[model samples]
Target: MPRLIWPLLAALLLGACASKPEESPERTEAAQYREAQSAMDANNYLTAIDRLKELEARFPYGRYAEQAQLDLIYAHFRSQEYPETVVAAQRFMRSYPAHPSLDYALYMRGLANFYMERSFFDSFMTTDKSARDLTSATDAFEDFERLVTRFPDSDYAPDARTRMVFIRNEMARHELHVARYYARRGAYIAAINRAQYVVQHYQRTPLVPEALAVMTAGYERLDQPELAAKSRRVLQENYPDSEYLDDDGQVDLAWWPREGKGLMSLLTFDLL
Candidate 1:
């Protein structure tokens, strides 16, 4: 009787175990993706990243893999880990060049740079400890330009155009600032060249007014009074309300001045 009972119990346990349904691979993948989504919703970005990575590894060709990759990139960005965010975004672009989300990925890549750029004043003071990020910003702008040019109808195009404007203005401002530094130090030749670059290359930029003011000041410092007067006249004519001019029709101190003693005298003189 004991042997018969034991055999029956073993058979019953085996039947119960065998009757349990096996989870389909699709179901497992769905479960993982759901977990990742839940983590993300909770703002547990690190956990979500780990879960999504696992999902991709286990189901590379699954329905959720692409979304997992996209979310991973976003997670890195949300974590303020820009380098990782860039890496993930670039990977997405390379892997799925024609994906509908490619535009978004490209835009994010550029936005990362925009956030990384130093303020105009910081760069001006030469106190920009974040100068290294400018390289990233330039690369991001290039990516954004590519997207706008290649996918003009993309939803991101307008934003990309706006960002391009910002980047161009920033670059123009940077050049103008360097020109101002040179002029202040009596490096009139260098200042004039930089100012000319702004005028010629970035004529339509917001910084044009400032660039023209710098050119007027630079020409004055270089003893090119004729050129200086022409530049000032143009500035006053084109930008009548420009704050670049003082009440006496003179360039502000922020602009270069003509009346200082020659560079040699200023360097050699000892004021008592």
Candidate 2:
């Protein structure tokens, strides 16, 4: 009789263990977040995205929702799905403008645009110059500028500042390239306008010296000696050691600086 009672007790204990209560959605969401974070740390971006999305849907208004959204953005970024990342970041910014992660959201938005703009060079080399992606890049630059201005003490501000410089330089380079195309075809007036646009819009960019050089050369070729000399004086005053000079004491007609490497005298331009 004692042996039979022991067997029955063991069976009861096993049934009780199997009948334990299911975890609440909150607890499940927490578990998912932890697992997704582990996956992200392992660089398993796709898995992390899936898990994070599930968490978001399962706890839409819960405490983990915001973190899930932020992680989703990071996952898209890691996967190089920049458009998706941008969309997620924009949504986060709109939905949680006052959240403590607002600065990070803004920075991610800018970074997405920065990467999207990189493809512009490929488009520019094609015949469809109008298809270039400068609009997105311009928007990004503005967003980053806003972030830096509004959240100066944010941890992302320094990165935003650096990206702003890169954007300015790229914009200036694009303008300089267009100016050169016009100048080579004897469109000196058009070239001058474009070069001046670069000087006016992207004065702090590394390409400013090359843009000034183009203006000087364009003015000279158009037989506007006074304007040519004036442009040269501006270049010399602003960039005394510019490498854009030619052997004939004139600025090179078709030269532009490498994208990020400015002339040593760029700091003296007083544009910043």
CA lDDT, every model vs. true structure: 0.80, 0.82
Cα lDDT tens digits, model 1, 17-92, are 9999997665589999999999999999999989999999999999987888899988988877777888898999
Candidate 1 lDDT trough over 10 residues, lowest sum = 124-133
**Span of ten consecutive residues with least summed lDDT in model 2:** 253-262
For model 2, the superposed segments whose C-alpha errors exceed 4 Å read: 1-27, 119-132, 246-248, 254-272
TM-score of 2: 0.75
In model 2, what lDDT does residue 36 have? Answer: 94
The positional error of residue 63 in candidate 2, measured at the CA in angstroms, is 2.2
- Please give the clash total of every predicted structure, in order: 0, 0
Q: Which pairs clash in the backbone of model 2?
A: none
